[model samples]
Target: MPTPGSTQRKFRLADDALWAEYDQACRDINGSTDRSDDIRKHVEAVVAEWKQRHKMN
Candidate 1:
């Protein structure tokens, strides 16, 4: 998966309510408490789809 040596990243939410909503959505889709890997996978999927649709490499 991704060569196994990826750099960690940090992101800030708009506010506490937004952060809570995002966290709950992740948890709901994951069906478990742990979201460490799910978040990355979801973000990657979103970025890939966006780039493909926009013809951006």
Candidate 2:
């Protein structure tokens, strides 16, 4: 659903809560850009950190 003359892409998540969690982490990491997401490695790492914070063990 790209708009004309726009380079942005869109994504859909199954839940808003998951997106909220990722958004918080993204801010902490200064966010992915220039293709730095690299297979979502950074996202996964931050999610691990969030789990640790919540004592999700």
Best by TM-score: 1
The per-prediction tally of clashing pairs is: 0, 0
Candidate 1 lDDT over residue span 1-57, tens digit each: 344788767666669987677678878987764556777788999999999989964
Q: Highest lDDT: give the candidate number.
A: 1
> lDDT by residue for model 2 over 1-57, one digit each (tens)?
446997874456789887766667666666543333543576889898999989965
Per-residue lDDT value at 23 in model 2: 67
Worst 10 residues of 2 by lDDT: 31-40
For candidate 2, what is the TM-score?
A: 0.38
lDDT of each: 0.75, 0.65
TM-score of each: 0.49, 0.38
